[model samples]
Target chain A: MSEWWTYRPSSFLLFSARTYYRLFELYNAEIWPWQVLALLVGVAILVLLRKPGTWQGRTISALLAASWLWVAWAYLYSRYASINWMATYFAAAFALEALLLIVLGVGHGLVWRPPAAWISRAGIGLATFAVALQPLIGPLVGRSWSQVEVFAVAPDPTVVGTLGVLVLASGWPKWLLLPIPILWCLVSGATAWVMQSPDAALMPAAAALVIVAGGGSVLSRMAPARDASGTPALD
Target chain B: MDEIIKAPPLSRRRLLGALVATGAAAAVGPRISAAQPDAIITRPIPSTDEKLPAVGLGSWITFNVGYDDVARASCAEVMRDFFEAGGRLIDSSPMYGSSQATIGYGLYTLGKPPALFSADKVWTSPGSRGPPQIEVSRKQWNVPRFDLLQVHNLLAWKEHLPTLFAMKASGQLRYVGITTSEGRRHRDFEQIMRTQPLDFVQVSYNVLDREAEARILPLAQERGMAVIINRPFRQGALIDRVARHPLPSWAGEIGCVSWAQLLLKFIIAHPAVTCAIPATTRPAHARENVGAARGPLPDKVMRQRIESLVEQL
Candidate 1:
């Protein structure tokens, strides 16, 4: 087998940028009314995140799991696989991520709590960007609104959203869940860069921001507990 | 094809200065009249003596538009123009995303041009999967049978080669061959070319990438095998690099009005190359590519001149 160093990222790119954008246009048309529903689900997740609790955490996880499973089956398997053979493997990995989320949510793994620091606030902002601002990038970059990648539907925003959600989480779930979305963002960022898309930096940048926040969440956990007041409190 | 790019008349002193600077005495080379050929230029396939057009269409990234109807219709237009311009061969592989299905849509939309020469490839592992993949590729192209089928990138060639030979012997396929690109696997490529009874071999060769000239071209000539040249423009990078410069004044000796045609003429002018396949997404570019086959080609001296000038650029 040939070594990996011999090949460039563009060598594996089998589709044109125009074709890639058109894929989303056609997909959006085919799955009409679902975009509306997916957006509603995203809004519901945001609402749940505002008031963190055990039940709210599980509900948010269930919502995210449903979105991941839908994207794996419909977008990756049914659509993207037609052009790229690698999408099959991507769909399988996405399905696995969804299953992991299901276990963390239903198996009573971790409790969702309000952030005590600016890092968690940044995570919330990143999640908001994926759900709200990311779609606007398409039209701003000369693509049509029909081709805008939406959260809970497209892989880029979904992965970004998951990373954001993970930053609001802690314990083993945060450690276990961060790798998949980060890897996806890096892969997709390289792909978009090869395609010369203007918003290519968004995914990789979101991944970086989440990694910092997730790390901060860990450091906060190790530190002495603090109350609503500025001073440290008894455990 | 008849359009000649007129250069400002240079004085004897200027012509000599340009010639010295460019290291080409192309001004004094044997000059063919700048007349387009009345018929499309063709070279004989060494194995069966079948004449294939010197220029063919390649579907790499250009035709992998997936299921977008708008993009698919645009591709159909490109194909329609290619056929009307007297091109015969259209090449694709299963590795090129949805290019095969896109080609099928174009063929079906055009009601299947009788002049279409369908060339495809088998790219799967373990060799047993070759037949099923080939069947799917045939269905995708909506063709009765492929004119040529090659093993892509030499993957699983040990197993795929025998399967291709059997298909060719049974007449289910017309030609059997193998392909490699970007200059990888040439040692194995050379070994296969020397040993296999292949009808065609597709390789990457252009003005800049001349690794093929040292051994592969000569080997193909020695073995009496046909050669299909891929990436004549280095997948559009070469053209982009030279698009801003004016064509060397001596280019008119071969009737090349555009850099695209000049680079293409450089490839097919070689005696061993049966065809050069250049992929494009626009109908105008498709028409321009086939125009390379319609005029006088660069002679040995002029081919050398083209290489030097492009190298400097």
Candidate 2:
């Protein structure tokens, strides 16, 4: 079965850590031993997959493993040791996971590569600008900061997945990556309506507009015609 | 500050009558059987004019279990049982890992109760010199309107109290309270009660921790503000201390079957206290905690007996 089961080290690590944290809260000491066993299992899988990795993949994999370790440490520390510093440790681990993902994507040359014309590149740039501007506008408009995750020019899983598919199907304008931020903002804005906060709605709305308009402009510059080798002109 | 707000007032007597009618229709209403011989004690939230069972569940340690579907579903069942047995207050916080998210999920799946009193807190640094960061708290709890928003452990109380007061004026929150547990900030707790125009305050007030009664409880009663007692079990430390000993025979006279009831009943006996929130992960514990709400609260004389029972430990 052609299931969507292709392994990405970063995504798997993120999902596993999140799941373990949830289980830790529910079962506490009852499941602590099982979590330790799972950590070992995750390390074993990483070691087995280490051979076929590029420098970028290896680096990303190591960062992913580190994030999980941080999460486990946070859980243990909160349960058995210092209760006060647990939140700081958890937030730091979360931010590190986001940073590592961005670094891994850039290093692997996955982002900033346009499969289409220069217009598409410009469109992506505009989208990026829009996403970045969301936080500034959100508070002015009276939205909560948590809504920024949806509205701001932050990386989203769906957009990244789409970009990966597009890249593999046919090399288009590298700038196609730009619109992902815009798409995230739009979806985030729509979700904010239920939140019933003006600031919540405003931030996401602003982000969506920037990403879509800028990303559209960038995508427009790319030529559809293929070269003699049947690859697109940008590639 | 008195702007002659012309909102309709909720009648407590009428609301209580309506609630009792609904409780009767629900079939599993307050277990008032003569064989049980326990009168369920109910207390009113002065601000909202809503009466809730004296003992409520705290979701801090129990509900912070994260975002798993099965675990969340199990918690939903616990909440359902709690409400069916006449629970109204559900306490939570952003600081308890994914507790807010878990509560959001539970409330979503279980559907909200009309009389539900959602209480949460904003935990920031103590010496911080800015606003209480209300926006972050709103998102974390996933509630548009929080019934009671407390400053967790006097952390940035001066900063948060003003914002909470403003929210109260805006009709976004019905009550404003402050909480201090584990005996961390008695001085700050007394200071806030003395100065601020708060509607409620929460502190650790089990049989073991009666220091609040000396000053804090009387101050709250004088101020006419309700009180919520947390850490009634001393974060399970009290339980560990009293585990080997059997419950004294008189505990049954007041309808307390377990040590959990003995602890909660002692807290509820205080005149200033409106409710006591005990955190428990097990559903049976939730049921037993709620059962503490039933029967006659120990009188001043009996209160001394209950304390003496624990003092033996």
Candidate 3:
């Protein structure tokens, strides 16, 4: 048998760039008007991101949970899986992410820190892009408006939006919520790269942005920890 | 052995060669059809002496269109062109997402062209599930019975081969075989080829990818197994590369107008190969591919020359 490393990214592509994009066209047409509902949900999540409180956090989390569950069933399971065998596993991951959002984000009510000034700006920027700007990128790149990938309705924007929200909230929520979206960005980015899509850089760019922006805060917080003697301790 | 060595129509092939030499072959333009004397070129299945067209259709990435009415209708047009050009043998697998359904749509659109030599694969786990998976594939293609059923990529071949053998034994299938692509698992593939009563074995082979020539091709000849060549253009990469260079001056001798035909002819010209299935989305390309099967094939010396030239490019 050939070793796993023998495979290239192109080896896994079972459909063409045209076919992959046409899937979104067919899917978007099949579930009409739901795109508006999904957009409203994105708007709600953004609104709650600004009102920093326990109930607000829980509301944001619940909205995200519903968004993810909807994507898991409506897009990944029903539409994308028809062209990609790996989408079934992606749907399961989305469902798992939704479950985590419900249990950790909604039930426990994550703590929202007034993020470090730059981090807060970055978070709002990313959230805005995910909900609003990303959809327009599809149409700008010559794809029909019907094929536009919307927030919460498509995996790319959903994952990016979740990352933006996670950046605004602090603590263990990042540890639980960040990995799936980060991993999904990498997967979706690679898929776009293989398909030679114009938005090939967007997902990976989002991932890198979160890692640098999100990871920097963690390091900064770690730097402040000291012994009672007012000296840093060595491990 | 004699059944596999049928000669091309000398008189008509010479006429095609003459047209190519005169630079008039460009005007032939989808004129090749079953009604023409040299339109259909067939080779015998070694085990059964059943004739299959030299070129067949493969549905890898090309026909995986999922409910896109435009793409599905385009796929149907490709099928229409393929059948009109005297081609049969459409190959697909469950691993190819929605391809079976797309083919079903095409077949339904074409009224399930009687010339279709339906080829599909059994791909699933536990070996016990193979039969049900094949049934699902059968329903997807909407065919009464597949003309050939292969164990895809040698996945669970030890368990699935027996199921295929039993099906063949009971006359539920016309032929049984195994398949692998991109030059994988040749050692295990050979073991099955040697031990099993296989009618056909599909493998990846092209002008650039010749790893199969070392052992697989010779072994197939030795075992009397008809060979089906897959990835004849390395999923279009090889053709795209060679298309950059001009066709060799000697191409007209064999009536090949484009590099796709040359690459496909190189594969199907092998004595052990019964067919080479190259997938394409355009109806014009489908007709062009079937055109490769007609006219004279390269001899041993010319085959070596063609290989050497392609390697340098």
Candidate 4:
């Protein structure tokens, strides 16, 4: 089989999502062979980055394919009769998580295998910025965010802004990372109080908690492991 | 290979039953005679008295099979069989991916059946329903004057109803209805049924799903509006559940050869239900579904049996 045929599951998922989004926008569904072909290309690129003769590459590739399959299955299930918009929304969220897992697994596959280049670094930066800005830009520009006839601009910056700042500060010294989670929690909690949707509030609160808990473990590991001159032993 | 061939053959008694069932189908296999061209069970339009087939094709997941030449050809064949079998009302919408196009292709290929009852919808949020969206939907379906148009899922019902009414008055549309499925928006469904002068109401009511019976069915009956039942098999979940079990002996009494007939009979048994649209992709499935329209429907006792059997699942 050709490389494109190997990633059939990913192609199906991309095709389904694109079909749904197109149907939602245009009120007519059209065949999107190109979208399916594009997803196959993405899977091929991810697979090519893996080391040869290693189980890690095979495992990561399988995971990517499985995630895409799950996303496609979820999308199909959501389209069934008797499911509401809320259920559909949650199913779509699961699809997004599956996509994120593919990204993370692909990133892990490339880790320590090759020397990181400026282009790779810039790509990572771009991805990080996009992920961090989702909540900030989503509430403002996202068509689904508000109920009003005329689009209402978001009045307050979201918890994503705080996370974006923290990600930007991650390039600096370890001490700078300490206050980021604290600031994130305060802003997120305040936003949670103001937002109409519980989902909107819950997301930021959950992100804040993850940052604090995960960051604390990293801080504890860094503290005693530092050398006498206050530089990290690994460095 | 020797081990694989070890299974025994069926007994003579079982073989006889299969022959009998096949014979029964063959007896009723022919199309309606010229004397009764409208032989299929048809319910009337509330206002105009135009009778549509009691069993219509629901094109949801089936029509979304997409751009595959073989699949498209098969769909066209199924549709041709449907129309040749005296099917008139072809239900579709923008919600189902490429369903409208598939229906269009089938109708176009078959030279457009004279009594084509084209029904399509507009799915939008509340207060966003406007002429622009309606016009776009009209162009998408490629129908100059839709025979029956419905507001999809009560989407912007307040805004769209007036537009539909205006279109009806101006002869842009023949009839107008509002549809809500899955029993999600019953409150809105009830409100429309009570307030609006609708010709039909589409809902999800199957042998497995009886939620629509409480208020929607009775209200439609009382208001003298036609009712269309969507998801008659609960989107194939009911079929999967019933597959393991044998067809009850009593089901044969009602002339039901398969579970599809039994389920569809239950929906049509309701005087309120004008038609039930159950979607299928396979040609065999389509033939089986359309076969439901034939033969005697289940009476009160058999309907109770169906309800109990579905409840057991």
Q: What is the C-alpha lDDT of each candidate?
A: 0.84, 0.57, 0.86, 0.56
lDDT of candidate 3 over A62-145, digit per residue (tens): 999999999999989988899888899999999999999999999988888834778888888899899999999989998888
Alpha-carbon error at A197 in model 2, in Å?
Answer: 44
Residue B239 of model 3, lDDT score: 84
All candidates in order of DockQ, best leading: 1, 3, 4, 2
- Please, what are the lDDT tens digits per residue for candidate 4 over residues B189-301? 89889999998889999987789999999998889898888989876778888878888866765556788888997898777888888887666666567556654556667
- Once fitted onto the true fold, the runs of candidate 2 whose alpha carbons sit more than 4 angstroms away are A1-235, B1-39, B46-49, B125-136, B139-141
**How many Å off is the CA of B103 in candidate 3?**
1.1
Question: Which segments of model 4 are wrong by more than 4 Å?
Answer: A1-235, B1-38, B126-130
Tens-digit lDDT string for candidate 1 (B113-169): 988989999999878999999999999999999999999989899999998899889
**Between candidates 2 and 4, the DockQ winner:** 4
Q: List, residue by residue over A14-124, the lDDT tens digit for candidate 4.
A: 122223222222211232333344344334433443333334544433443353344334232334211122324434543443344344433333222211233233323
Model 3 residue B157 CA deviation in Å: 0.6
Error of 1 at A19 (Å): 0.5
Per candidate, the number of residue pairs that clash is: 0, 35, 0, 0
Residues B171-219 of candidate 2: C-alpha lDDT, one tens digit per residue: 9888899987656668878888889988888887889778888888898
Query: Which of the two, 1 or 4, has more DockQ?
Result: 1
Candidate 2 chain B, run of 10 with poorest lDDT = B1-10
lDDT for position B115 in model 4: 62
State the weakest 10-residue window (summed lDDT) of model 3 chain B: B28-37
Residue B303, candidate 4: how far off, in angstroms?
Answer: 0.1
